[model samples]
Every structure is written in C-alpha cells, then in structure tokens.
Target: MVDDVADSVGSVRPNCSRSWSNSGSFDLRFASDANGKYPSKIDFHQIGAGFGGHFWFAHTRKPGAMGGKMKVTGTWTLDHERTGPMKIMAALPDHGAHTEIANYRVNATRGPGGRVTKQPGDGVRWVSIGTYMFDGVVPKVTLSSETPYGTGENDIAFDAMAFIPIDGQYHEHTVEADALFDENQNIDTAAPESWLNESPLESRERLYNWAMTMSDKILSMKNCDSEVGDCLTPHVGAAVANWRSEVMAAGKDPINHPDGNSISSWIGFANSYKDRPDSYTRPDSFDDDSRFKIRTKATTTFVSDENGKIVPGSQSASYANRTADTHLPHFVLELFRAISEDYKISLPDLGYRAKDLNEHNGEYTSVDPLRSGIIPGRAYSYGGQAPKLTTYTGSGEQRGATCVAVRTVAGGSIGYRTLLSKEGPTTAMSDFSDTLSNSQYVAQSVWELVENIREMFFDSGSFPVVESSLYNVAPPIWQDLNFRACTNETVRKVDGYPILRASWMPDHYLYHNGTAMDQSGALRKTSLPLMRGDFENFSTATIEVAHEYTPYGQCRAYVEDNSFARNKNPWGINPVPRPGFNPSSVQFCSDPDLAPDPEYSSYDVS
Candidate 1:
C-alpha cells in the first residue's frame, strides 16, 4: 500500500498486500514523482530513494509554506506504492501526512532509526488507518500537512495517495494474540526498531524462491521458432556483462582501452542507452484536470530548497522508466531494492557487488551447475548463477567432462578474486544456498534483457522499455495451509504446513557445445529445486509461508464480538494481547484452524 504516512499519520489499506493476484498485470498506476506543484520553493531535504525515487518534503515553519493538502473526492480512500508495472503513469510526489476523514492516528514513524513507520503492519504493505463511513462527495477525505508538531519543528512528507471504494462492511482482525506480533512475528516493545530488517527465515525463503524462478525462466522458454523478443533474455550478454564487471571493478577493464572494441563508459553500467523519444506526453486519466498528463518514459528530478520544498531540476523525459539508482528499469533496479528491503536481506548476506550483472559477456561459475554457489571471479556478478538467456552452451565446442572454456580471456586473471588466495581453484564449493544471490539479480537483469532482445526481435521505434514492475507469489486463498508443490516431486514440505523438509534446488540442466562446453542445471538432480518460477513458464516455485492464525477475524458471536477498532483511540480498550480470560478455543474468521481444502491441487506462483 503506502510507505511513509509521515508527520500526520500512516494510512494504508488493512487487507492490502505486496504479494497478490494480478500483481504484474498492467493497471492504473500512479507514479509518485515530483511535478513541482507546490506553491513555494523551499530547500528540499533528501530522504532515502523511496517511492518514485524520493518524496515531497515540506514544513509549516516556512512563512508561506504550511505544507500541502490532498483532496480525494471519493466515497473511500486508500494508498498504494504502485511498485509494479502501470498502464497509467502520472507522476505524483509521495510522502507526508494527512489530518482526516475518519481521523484515525497511526504509528507514523519508525521508532527512531528508520524513516517510515508502520501502523498496523510490516510497513511495506498499506495498513489501514481505519475504515469509516463517508458520504459520496467531491472531496471524500482531505489530508493536510498540518500536524500537532511545533511549527517548523517537524517536517511533513507530501506523498501520493490512492482513492478506492470499499464495501459497506469490512473490518480488521482483532484477536489480541493474532495481532500481537510485528512483521517479524515478535511481540511489540518500546525498544527502538530497525524497520528494514525482516525475519531471517522469511528472507531466506524469498531468496530461495527467487533462485528457482530465475533459472526456470532461462530454461523454460524455448528459442522462439521465429524469434519472438529474443526468447526473453540475453544470456550470453549477461554473462559477458558479469565478466566485464569483474575486470572493471578491479580497475582492470580491457575493453575501455585504446585497442579494444568498447562498450564500457563506466565500470558498473554499460553506456549502451540508445536512441530516445522526442517527448513523452499522455493524458493523466486519473486526473480530472484536462491539462494534467502522464509519462511512462521517465520521472523528473527535484532539488530541495531552504524550506523543505523542491524545485524542478534539469531532468526531462529521458528518465522515463529509468530508475535514478541504476538508470535501469524498475524490474531490475527498484525491484532489487524492494526484494532486499521487503524481505530485509542485506547484500553482504547475499554476496553481490553485481558490477558484472549487466555486462555484455560477464559470467561467474558455481561449482555445481544447478546447485547455487559462488565461483571465483572478481566476485562481481550480482546475478551470478542465473542461467544466461542465450546460453551458448551447446553452441560452443567443449573438451572436458564438464564445460570448459576454449579460449580463456586474457584479463580475467588480473582482477579476479581467484587471483588472490582463491586462485587456481577455478570453481566454488557446491552449496546450493548461494543461489539466492543469482535469483535476486537475475530477477531484475532478465526483465530488461528480455525486453531488449524482443525489440531486436522486432524493431524499437524509440526508447527502451523502462518500468518498475512488481511480482509476488502467495498460497491460494481459502486453502491457506494446503501449500504444496505441483507434485511431491518438486516441493518438499512438512505435512500440510509451510515448513520445508529439505532445501529445494533446480534439477534441469542445459547441454553444452562439443569440444568446448558449459552446462546448466544438473542431470544427477532428480526433481527440480522448489520450482518458484511461475511466470509464462510453468516452473515450480516455493512460497515459504509462516502464518499465525489465532482466530482473530470476526467471531461467530455476532455483535457480541465488536472489537477494539471502534473503541475510539482503542489504546485504553480492555481484553487485549490475549489475556488469559479469553479461551483459546474461540473461533474466528470465515474459517478457523486454517483448514486446507480437500481437493486443492495448484501451487500457483503469481
């Protein structure tokens, strides 16, 4: 839903989730980029690269700046990060606060360390402030920057808001015990918190699932009979990119020299951005104003002034679909940030400098083709172990039992991590866990790679496809605890639960060219690793779900079960955190015990 709800209070939809059906579908997405709509130009304060790169910052302290106001003219209101692909891309500045509609105050900031706070949440999802009755009107709810904080003392974030219609009856779960844990499944405390960290198990789950999905994507798609979008990836080039990144990061790039054919203008990124569009101008369908427009191409940059307001910088349409961080699409650049942030996996934990991720022919090998592990290179390829889209394995000639290089590139040794104490041992130990790093980077790298190859399939009239796309997987609703792989072949779980009996790994492998060959996946492997790759390809994937169903939903007792949400300010309400007085036998939700559907069969990943 929404990220920083700001000095006012955080407002998010109670039932919203980052993982949902129809996630990657094209939709009415409002990009939260600055449009320079604010009245004054105060010095803008920089926050982390959040929704739409950064959010709008303002303060009531400025003589003429009291903060901005947003009017949502609808029956109900909600906010979403729009961290996915969009059909309608209107740049809206995202951040800050609001005064009221139902007037529910929320936990607006991370205790002290993190910038954004979660009210009823993991903070990543849009948690609801509260659902209240509102008359059908032009301005259903108006949010203002004004807060109880002393003038100029607090800075308000003016960010994007989403307006939605809700059913007449909807409420949040209130079982004291069920609502007790933070996203980490821990009891709440006054202790300062780090909003960025997630339960390690959850992170590991995501990391593993991501790996299975990445490899499946590479292997599942057949070389298009007629070359439709270059079979959805640029495998060889990705490998080359990693290779180059390794060489370059160590200040040993051979391509950017006087004699070599060059692609590197920089060490990490390829200056391969090509022909651009003249301008991007489309009507903002969401905006009733006849003149408002949207641009799918790029968002503009703004610099803050003295009063926390911003002024437009020299940025233009070139930024369309490009993220400020990597100048890459959202799927690769921003999504990388999201996977790491949402799941709270650190790079060090994952092992990725990733300079090699986008290179032309960069690659790092894992000891076992299918099992995930890091081989010796410069340790550059962020998306290491991800199979190349155009894996020229069989296309080359090989001489060894396993794939071997026919001609080893010269400079690879100069900047290689192997050149250090790690030298001579060409590959890494077989450890499938490292596959997470491969999947994380491949998740992003493959998107644009596929897009570009498709264009080469046809012909791009203008700029490349740049978009922030969101992808997620969850167990089928109504069958909450019946999680399983398509068959017991791919997924191995505890009886009727989310626990994995063993770590899953991919079994599929690619054959290499004669004389010189490279292999992917493994023949020794019998079952595919937790096939989490649920895209157009039907690869098996595992969604590690750990739910605590404490029967928190509406109890069957009807009106006698009215919960604390309606208890004005609820903090003083009684019978909370599951006092011993309440029996554990109480039933809740449309179902209790999270019973599994007897006939469920699909392990859907979407």
Candidate 2:
C-alpha cells in the first residue's frame, strides 16, 4: 500500500538564487563657526589649497576677469560621531577624530593688474563637509574644506560618500552639496530638509495591496478546463474543489467569502448560526401500552451495635434498573419511522412474546436422615408468567429463602424487601430476566422493521436476507419457514460477513508483540527510508495506486466443497512453495528483449 498522503499542502518553496539592489543619493549642506584658525597662509589667487596634507577650496575670481583673483576668508570647525552601537569597551577611553569641510563661493571682480583682489558681491558663503578620525583618547579633525567662491559668481561644491558599518560591513551613501541662496551669496540651512524628506523608504500598504491582487488572480486561473463538457469548466472550480478537499482532509472548514458590506455584520451573522438548536420530533412507541421507565434497588447490609440498634455497613450493593417504557421503545421505533418516512417506505410491526418463567420440583432419598433423608430441588422454566402472582415467606426468624416476582405494569418499577436472620441468612430474587429479555425482543423487532423498510425501497431480489453474521449475531430462523443446508458456494459468496475476532489490538500486545525493533534498539520504526532507497536503486517501484488486469487464461481457480470443516483443503492446490521463492529478499524482473539500450536509458526512458 502507498504511504499515507499528507493532510495538507506543505509551505511554498522560495527561490534561493535571486538578488536585488537598492540605490539612491542625497544632497546636504554644512555650517561652521567663523574665527577658526587656519594652519597655513591663505592663497586667495588660486582656486584650491593644500592644508595639513589635504586639499581645500580657495576663493577665486569669476571667468572674464583680467588680472586679479578674488580673496574670501572664513573659519570653520566640523563635528561628527557614529550612530548606533559600537564594539569598543566602555571602560577604555574613547579617542577618535572626525572632520567636516565647508564649501564657499566667492563673488568678485578682477582688477587691471596681476594682483589679488578682495570683493563681496554676495556676502561670503560657507558650507562644510568632510571626514574625521580619532585615536583611543580624543577626536581630531582629519580633513576639512570650504568653497572658495561665493554662490552665483562661481559654483563651489563639496561631495563625500558616508560609510556606515552595519553587521560588520560598511554601506556607503553618496552625499552631494547644493548651494541654496536668497539673492545674496549666503549659505541656506533649509537645503538639507528637502533631501531628508525624499529618503528611500518602502511603503507597507502598497506591498500588501500588490500581494492581494496577485493572489486573487492566481486563484482565478488555477485549473481552467474549458474544452471538456462534463469536466469542471472554470479554473476557479478546480481551485475551489482542490482547496475544499484539502481543507476537509485537514479537518478544517473552507474560508468563507468576505462580505461586500461590513465585516463586523458578517461576523455577527456567522456567530449567531454557529450553534443553532436542532429540532427533533417525539419518537413513536412500539406498543401502545409500553412506556419507558427507570427502576433502582438498594441492598444494604446491617450489623448489630452495642446498644442493640441496627447499623448500616459500608459493604452494600446498589442496583439501578431501567425498563423500556413508551419513551425508550418509542425512540427506537421512531428511528425506524423516520427512516421509513424519509425513504418513502412502509414498515410493519413484528409480534413479540412476553416474559416467561416456570418451576418443577424433584425428590431424592439418601441413607443419612439428618444430612439428606429426602432432597427437594426445583428447576426454573423459561416461559411466560403464571396467571396468579405469588410471594413466599420464611418460616424461621433467621432462615434462607428464594423469592421471584414479575412487574406487570406498563412502565416497570422496583419492588424490594428487607430480610432479617438470627443465624444464617440469604435472599434470592429474580426479575431482571424478564426486563432484559423484553429489551432484546424490542431490539429485534426494530431490526425487522428496518429490514421490511429496506425491502420496500430496493428490488425484492436485490434485498438479501442480511445474514445476522454481518453484525456478529447468530443466524435467525423462522419457526414456520423450512431450513435449507447452505452450499459451500453460497457460503463463500456471502458479502459483509464480520469475522469473530478482536477489532482493536490490545495495549499489551501492541506494545510488545506488534512492535518491531531496529538494529539500534528503537521500536516502531517504519521501513520508509529503506524502501525509498530500494526504489531509488531500481527506478521502477510504483509510487501510486493503480490497477492491472491478468487475463483469465493466465490464472487458476481452486475449489472446496466441505462446508462443515473449519479449514478445508482446496482441490488442485500444491503443498510445496512456488519456484524462485526468496523470503528475505525483494524480487525485480527484467526482460532483455524488452529493455532499451543502456546508452539511451537515462534520457527520456519512461
């Protein structure tokens, strides 16, 4: 048999070999304080300067100037620090140096001579950007720069890529400088605000909406079959059918369609119908006089106390008796009635016999008079009750006696009495035989009713006798019907015959006898891995259930005629095992003539 199928589909596999990139750039500005010290003499004539082994922008004249260059001077300091966590020990002193450079644009006009000039058409503009580094003790500015030319006169810009370390790796962001001005050549701080607002960040709502639309489209196109007339025509049909089967197999319900209106209203409606009450009509009675009833009898043992008062002992037995009155029998009868009504069949009540009891006395003589001179014994009969009800009373105060009584009420009731004895005392009562026997009779009557109803619905010949063996009961016989000997063919052809064996494995047997131990001493291991390996080797093992028919000429039939024997021998059966038997091995067959060539076997050989 194939391995049990999984109850639900597994999680969707994800693509492992895919990659993507996120790229963007931002513009920023810088600010600095004036009066900062310059390390070297300023060169206002040139457009660049070398300060502390780093390049810096110097003020210069605009194009079309004749001889003199512009001179712009400004002092600035840079501040920088890393954000987020760092692996450095807090106990140790932190020493790091960071630097920022300012870009300045010079607004000036040259003079006639080849000498430098100082002029400010727009007030000197300064914006800083650069890098800083630090040792274990204190931070120091590593690189700093400022634009030498003022805005509009000559555009001066500062550009740097900031590297931020994440997960022990650095991600770099390209930063560019944009000079913002207001008619004058001063730096504007609001230049950074617009760049910050346009930062690269994903929107969660857009992603959700896209996923929803894709899922709906996938569901819509799942199993579209438009050609076949009787097949599920639409893709949605196949998808829903497959989904419903999966949900049912997993012991779950399908997801309900969302309401076009408010979800709360739909939820409320669903909750209202979750556990709606069921309506059942009252059951009919088997007999008009019969009624359902419960009868209980409590038997208590008492011991004499020191004060001569009877005290109840813990050792006592309570018997609860229930009789089939109109309710229970009516319920049973009503089940058949309902089945009959639903199937549009008629059922007739089969007659039943009442409870019966009888007794016969016998006499025997012995040699010893005191021990057993004459022995009197009674044999109880199993038949209907006698006309007159009788009650027996004991002659001695403490003597043993037997009492038998039957309740004739439509609904049975409990009748109990206390017996007291001074020496040896015992009491015997028998009434449940009738009650239990009546219950069985009622059950059989219901069965007969169902049988008749079934006969009405199905073809007369098709409705078999429904052998009691199907229910593990003895075959029933009708007193007026003739008994026929069952032929072996008839007995073997019967269907649905229940075997008289244990249906469930006993706990002890299952734990000990049924469990198989592996080489590692682990119990209850399946041979799935071994079987899978075997299949992988041969590449011919079947993975699904399928059918193959053997021609009638290729098979043989055995016959047996001894119906009375428990284990009969079939004619034409061989006693010895068949040829090529291997108890501990799996067999694989291959015909050389039918097999493909080895070279082409690996390619499209199915």
Candidate 3:
C-alpha cells in the first residue's frame, strides 16, 4: 500500500526506489517489483478511493497514423503484473475519452458500474478490461495511451491500478502486511551459486521436519473437503507430480529436480546462506530472478474481439504468425526452482499423475464454474488433462472476479507471467497481500482440479485404483490401507494387481471416529522419515541386519491397481463409497473369521 508519492514511504532502498518528479512520463511500473511503489502514511485522497498519486502521460505529438490527428495514449504499464487474466480496473481521469484503458480494449463500456482494478492490488478503479485467462509469456497490462477517435482526445491521467479480489474485496488492508514485511526487509546480497558452500543438504534438521509435515498430509488421505485441513490426498499427489513434470518438460525447473537434487538434498539451501536467519525466506536468487528485477519493454499478448468466444478458434489477432510468446520455448525456469520444495512443489515425477480436463474460463461477472457450464481457464488447465489442477494462486491474481456467459476455451492456458525478466518462487511470496491472493487462487484452482479428477475417474465407468497398499481384496478395494500392510502381502493389491503399495496410497482413506493419527491405529499411524529395518541401509548408515531391506527411494511397484472402494456418502453411491469393493474385502489379518497366514514376508519395498 505504498503511496505513489516518493516521500510518503518510510524508506526507499536501492532495489525498489521511486522517482517522483510530481510530473508525467512514459515510464511503466513493475507490479511484481519486489520493492513496489510504497505508500505513505498520509493518504493523498484521504478516502481510500485512490492510492497516493497518478501517472500523467503527454507524449511529444505523434509522428505517424496516431499522428498529430489523434492524441496518443500514455504509457502506464504493469510488467510481470497479471498471473492470469482477472478483472483489470484503472483510475479514470476526470475526462471521458479514456474510460477504456486496459489492454483488452473492450469498449470500456460501463457495465452496471461497480469496481475494476489493476496494477495488481492497488485500488479498485472505476472501469474494466473484463476477465480473461492467458498463459503466454510474462503477464502484463500496459494502459497504453488513449486514442479514442485518433484525434481530439483529452490528455491521459493514469493513477494507480488495483486488482479486485474475486470476492470483490478491494481493501485488503496492506497496512498490517506492510509492518510484517518490514520486519523481513533484511536481504541476502550474495550470488545464488555461492550458497552451496552452506552445507549439510541431506541431514537438515529444519527441512526434514518440514518434509515430514508434507508427508503427513499425503498419508492423511484427507477428503476433497477444504473444511478439512490441507488437501493432500492421492489425487493431490498426482496433480503435484504431473505439474512438476510439466514444468520440467518445459525446461522450467532445473535445480530441485528428481534426477538432480533430491528435495532432501537441498530443502534448506537458501536458509543456510541467509545473512539473517530471521529475515523473510529469501529464495535462491531474489535479486536476479524477481519479476520486478528489470525489463526494458512490456511484452504483448492480444486484444480479442469481445465476440471472440462464439467462434471456432477465433484468435482474430496475431499469434500463429508472430509466434508471440509469454515464455520462449515454454516455461520461465526462474522462480519455478526458488520455492520448489515449498511453493513450487516441483519434485520429480511420482509416476502416477493422471490427466482430466475441466474448464472454468469466462468473463468476470459471468464466470461461475459451480453454476455455469464448465469452461477451461488456462490455469484450470481444461483440456490440460492430468490427466489437471490449480492448487495455488492468489486472489485478484486470477480466480477472484466477476463473469459473464461463462465461455469455455477449448484448450489450455497460453499465458505466462513474465516479460524479459523472470520470477523467483519468492516473487509474489514476499508481499503478504500478494501471498494471500496467490494462495486463494491456488486453493480455488486446485479444488476445481481435484474435484475434476474425482469426476473423471467416476465417469470413466471403471473403478479407480490410485495406489498399492496392503489392505483388502482386489474388487472390494481392501488395499487402501496403510503402507505397513504391504509387509503382510495377503491383502496388498489395487484392483487385482499384485503390486506393493508405492505411490497414491491414499486411494480411499478412512477417518476413524477418534484419536490423533501417528498415536495409534494400524492404517492411520505416522510415517517414518525413512523406511524401517533393512531399509535403513538407504539412509546414511552402515547397519548389519539379518535381511537387507528396500529403501523407500528404491522401493519397487510391480503391478498396477484399479480396484474399487465403497465411496457411498450422503451423495448416493454409483462407484461405491471410497475403499469398499465388497464386504469380504477385509485384510486377512483384520478379518474376524480368517486365521493369519503361516508364511510371513518381512518387507514390502514401495
């Protein structure tokens, strides 16, 4: 919430300083600027209606077509600004000609008039550029100079742009976030590569603990309910796995790849090199990879005909020709690695990511995925197939907005938030408000994705066999139990396959009536950071055991499981409630009428 006025902010550092000539310019603001135009204690307008100042653009008379005949549009831009197309609003000048300012170039026709915002999280201005979902290179919206009639247009006065949250909550109260951010202002000024000397990648106490938390959620098999805590079901694991693969395939992720640095090998890499341990988590290369770092020009996407969605492939502008790119050769390999372990979640492929397509793309006011026909927003990855998920994004960044006749784009996202610059996983993570928006976006998108996956499996007309754990009979899905069941071998199967439980173990998790997990019960116990017994050999140890155990990292999953589980809930069961193929599907050990098999297998690799 920094005031545009230079003097208003508490302090200006080298990274994020502002120039206040109190005049006008052709300068575009970097919305992703790690150090954005800070606000002052003294609100200029005093009424929260607008941010501190404005950008007044008066170009030296046009030379050609937009030539002297029409007044040229001013250049106020937000580079690396929009993640996906959300509602974009601008502070309209006291004049009438510039009502429509955003890049979309929709007539700026005033709708029943409520709020529109841009410059991501500034303040909801008066008009809009509608809503869109782009996945091209670096997301940007330069409020180009106004040329209403190509002549006789009024001078352009562009004030701050604001990002309207999907919930329409404009005042995010940055004041609170500001103080918290100030506390973390301590920056690490070293080159990113030098951090390797910081040591002990494998035996990191802090990172190991964090890794355990992630592992717990995976094992929890939490339902599709956000009302429940973190949604880390097998479905989520698959989504994460798939997305990680996608980024890597795009050549985006390099360092934290499975083939390279096992996350265990470098979870706390940056923390080790931190100048001040207490500072905000400075990612590997904040200075070099920030979206706001530096870029000479803003990249261009397109101005679609408002009627663009009604036709087949109605990209009336230029893309196939110019091959316009938001990210050349696909992904921006910057921030994808910065927070790989935490935010990016870019681990090596777990070998179980399924693809399903669901779309939620539309106009801001008419975009209702739950209520409208499912259209795919690029982020929704509709047609993106998972088989798909948007588990993380911030408010106003994409999801939060109004919509009109929900238009389903037939493909996947075609936009990337960048310019000539790159983003660190820590880019948006730095600011509290941006972080909040990002998380909200991720939550909504992921929810849509996971739910879509569930529907896809159910609709496929076949039972879903997510993981291989030893639990129940094949058809009855007795195998959704804890991984420990893998040791017995009797009930270890997924849809009749003879594989040990490896990936996607939370096929149909059961939440017993009481007691905390890890404290008791067979299927719901806590997971060990490392495997047990002979598996200990995988760890940094020289143990002499009677039998050599298999390390989890090297565990093998021989067969594919497609078993059915009773998923019947109050919603009525078609595919049966989760984890219930049949009544006789109980593990031989858990079966009341059966006796334990005389033969015992000590280990289950995966």
Reference-based lDDT, each prediction: 0.21, 0.18, 0.23
**lDDT (10s digit) by residue, model 2, range 386-494:** 1111113212112121111111100011110000110111111011112222442232322332333222221112112121100011010000000000111011111
Ranked by lDDT, the better of candidates 1 and 2 is: 1
Candidate with more favorable, higher lDDT: 1 or 3: 3
Question: What clash count does candidate 3 reach?
Answer: 83
Expressed as tens digits, the lDDT of each residue in 171-210 for candidate 3 is 1000000000011111121122113222112223333343
- Name the runs in model 1 displaced over 4 angstroms: 1-40, 43-48, 60-125, 169-606
Could you give the C-alpha RMSD of every candidate to the true structure, in order shown?
29.6, 49.0, 28.2
Q: Pick the candidate with the highest TM-score.
A: 3
**Runs in model 3 lying further than 4 Å from the true structure:** 1-85, 95-125, 134-137, 146-148, 164-606
Return the lDDT, model 2, position 341.
Answer: 45
* lDDT score, candidate 1, position 419: 15
> What does the lDDT read for residue 600 in candidate 3?
13
- TM-score result, candidate 3: 0.19
Instruction: Determine the backbone clash count of candidate 2.
Output: 38
